[model samples]
Target: MTAGRPAPAGPVWDRPEPPSRAALSPLSRERIVAAAIALADADGLGAVSLRKVGAALDAGPMRLYGYLSTKDELLDLMADAVHGEIELPLDAGWRETLRALATGIRAAALRHPWFTELAGGRPNIGPHALGVMEAALAALDRSGRFADIDEMMSARGTVTAYVIGAVRSEIAEQQVERASGVSEAEWRTATGPYLKRMLATGRYPTLARFVREGADRSAEEWFTAGLETVLDGLGQ
Candidate 1:
């Protein structure tokens, strides 16, 4: 309390060292992309950003610049990372392999709804994506049904396009159900009257038949049926 004369120091235990900041988690491109995917999964694709990813990873956004140059690159990384989840059939024939592969992609899209908006949305030359492409090429060529590059590419393009379109529809329905706060069955029941009204107009005879027949299938069933038809056409 008095002037500086060298006061007695407190006990070592009483004057303990101050706690310092905890160490930050290790940073890498995989960690960054994984954090972004987690954010996107919890919230949505719109929620993913460099700042949020950094926060999720306990690192500053600037640290990610070394691995991901820009937000676009981050998105590509996230997309390709998801592509790594697909289950490819190694020894199956072209039709079976392509069918399984496409179904797997759709399943992955369902698992990560954001994937529907990503895969093939850009020039995905990433390794996992390229690997999938390579597998598809090998499967299609293994049939020996396709003579050359053009045929092979066309077959691959057709299946790829089909998978993308089918998954887009699946994602759209899911988004609608999520936004409406209702399951698909509930939403359909809620709108049954309007759909019936629209069908009753007689202008949509085919639509009326579909509604009246109530011929329906699960999303997976529908996708499989459409894929079988496409494969049939291609084989023929």
Candidate 2:
């Protein structure tokens, strides 16, 4: 060292190095969103909160703020993560593509029932969500069925509306069954006598006829039938 220069600051050799601290699991947006999703899956959307998600991660609620600004933002992330579950077929026709997309979305919604609540109300701009939109639009554009982009978008919107509405209804029924601890079949059987009594009054002839004549179809059958009807209309 130069005589005029102060010796460079050096570590204290006599002192033991600071006790090694155990590494905490690293926090990330992915981990935070995943934790939030798990809470939503186990319970309903209402069960998920920053505090609870933080607790799941062994972090404080404030620690989540670094990755998420608000609960709505967290919800957006969760919705997109579920959207990632949808599989897009690359070589199918437009109608088939749309069908597959709708089916995939319905499956995802059933898996994460809260997803139906978040869907269709706001724009989902996350990459996975945007990929879904892109796949639909690209299929329509490639089909050459639309007069213009406006018509194409209208078709897409219509399908989206139908899927969201149908899935919401399905989820609502599932929730009702869960809450009542009664299956739909059991509920119908239990209420059949009362329904017959009410229909016997002759005020609901159409409903009575439908009740007697309507085919017993699974929820999947109903959903697929509705989806096909929508697609048929679009194909025209």
Candidate 3:
């Protein structure tokens, strides 16, 4: 060997190699979304971010970019993943199937409160979300009960809209209770004076009567009653 110029850095292989990244958690779109969903479920949707999700996997935020281009895409993926969870029966009739679908969707929303919060932020045309829609549509269309196509489609929309609206309200209350550590009924009781003052104004006679006579409705009772009302409207 000529032994010149510090031996030419000893054939380059003598340089120390990077400590193998083998210990790093492998990441994928599904894994990233799952991490985000887990964070959201444990905390709330506001808590999910690329940095937080990556940290959950013990990786860096840049690793998530390959899988999710933007935060909205991750949210969409999380919503659709929940959509895939709604269990459907193999051969239930239209009314029964739609009812079950609505019920399952509500259960899923309650299971993941952030789901109801983000679902309406974007149109969920992802595969699983579309699969849910197609399943409900196929079931409804097969019944041939409506006078026209518009009616049938509207029926699907009615059920979907009702469930989204109802579950969103239910979950918002649950989250508020969690955050404030005060039950909703307790909050209402705390605000009873304002309600009575408003009632004294005599602006809402119907509301006043309901307040005086109506039994306290549980979340399920409210949701089920609203769902049945929507279903009854669709049956016409």
The true-versus-predicted C-alpha distance at residue 186 of model 3, in Å, is 2.4
Model 3 C-alpha lDDT per residue in residues 132-216, reported as the tens digit of each score = 7787887877888877778777888889888999898888787679889998779989999999999989999999999999988
Q: Rank the candidates by TM-score, best first.
A: 2, 1, 3
Residues 71-97, model 2: lDDT tens digits: 777898898899999997796788998
The per-candidate count of clashes, in order, stands at: 0, 0, 0
State each model's CA lDDT, in order: 0.81, 0.85, 0.80
Best-matching candidate per lDDT = 2
C-alpha root-mean-square deviation, each candidate: 13.5, 11.7, 11.2
lDDT of 2: 0.85
Estimated TM-score per prediction?
Answer: 0.85, 0.86, 0.81
Better of 1 and 3 by lDDT: 1
Off by over 4 Å in 3: 1-23, 197-203
lDDT: which is higher, 1 or 2?
2
